[model samples]
Target: MNGSVTSQDLGEIFKPIVESFGCELWGIDFNNSGRSRLLRIYIDKTERPIDVKDCEKVSRQISGVLDVEETISGDYVLEVSSPGIDRPLFSIDQFKMYIGSKISLKSRIQKEGRRKFNGVLKKVDAQNIEVEVGKVDYVFPHSNIESANLISDY
Candidate 1:
């Protein structure tokens, strides 16, 4: 793909590949920073926990496809793995799934005079999610979220 390719574009491209392996494409994180670039793909399986074999299988397929499609320019490391316990939340559906769980998120822009929030996920809707930090509930539009991740109870 081109430099302009968004995460959503990569998601659309890989969703089918991931599904063919009997897995769900949980999310994709592409970090292009400094001299190195990293493309991280998180996959999930409903039936069982993901293992190294699964990651290797998906990695091989994705690597081949990326090579043929030139999906990413220049040198980049491709990593395929599970989201883990402190899984990063990518979609609104993910947030919905983790309702009532502790989460921390960073917004692209300051909301209520803060860009970072650590709280209990109270509610999720189509457009927004409510997180209670301390006793105050904060509503954040989905578009404003830069990154969010569950706070592992462990």
Candidate 2:
């Protein structure tokens, strides 16, 4: 699969493999950068912090599966690592988990005459999320958000 494959499909393909090793499949980012594509998978565990060993294990296992199944074509980098402090939020559930935390995001459509926003994540439900940017509260639909990540100042 090239750029045609959706991240959700990739997530379904990898979630079992990631969870088998006792980790949550945080998200998958499939980027087509000119000649080469990038498939970055973020993994996390509820019990402990992820380390190089965790990444290595996941990469090694996932690489074997991908090779055997031919899930991806062309030269692409397969990265399996932790989301780090500034973890990219991919789903509403992920957004819910980070409520009350600082976040920065860019919307696909303009909101309030701007596309970029930085604020404390105040609320997250099924359809949208409310973020407090200073004194203003901005609501962004799940579909409108292009990219979002936690902001860890510490």
Instruction: Output the number of the TM-score-best candidate.
Output: 1
The runs of at least 3 residues in candidate 1 whose Cα sits more than 4 Å from the true structure, single-residue gaps closed, are none
Task: Estimate, for each residue in 1-154, the C-alpha lDDT of model 1 and write its tens digit.
Answer: 6766778999998999999989999999988776788899999999999999989999999999989999878888999999999999999899999999999999999977789999999999999999999999999899989999999889
Question: How do the residues 9-65 of candidate 2 rate in per-residue lDDT, one tens digit apiece?
Answer: 889999999998899999998895687788999999999999999999989999998
Superposed by TM-score, candidate 1 places the C-alpha of residue 85 at a distance from the truth, in angstroms, of 0.2
Q: State the local distance difference test value for candidate 2.
A: 0.92
Clashes of each: 1, 0
Q: Give all candidates' CA lDDT scores.
A: 0.93, 0.92
For model 2, state the Cα shift of residue 62 in Å.
Answer: 1.1
All candidates: CA RMSD (Å)? 1.0, 1.3
Show the colliding residue pairs in model 1: 1-71
TM-scores vs. true structure, each candidate:
0.96, 0.94
Give candidate 2's total backbone clashes: 0
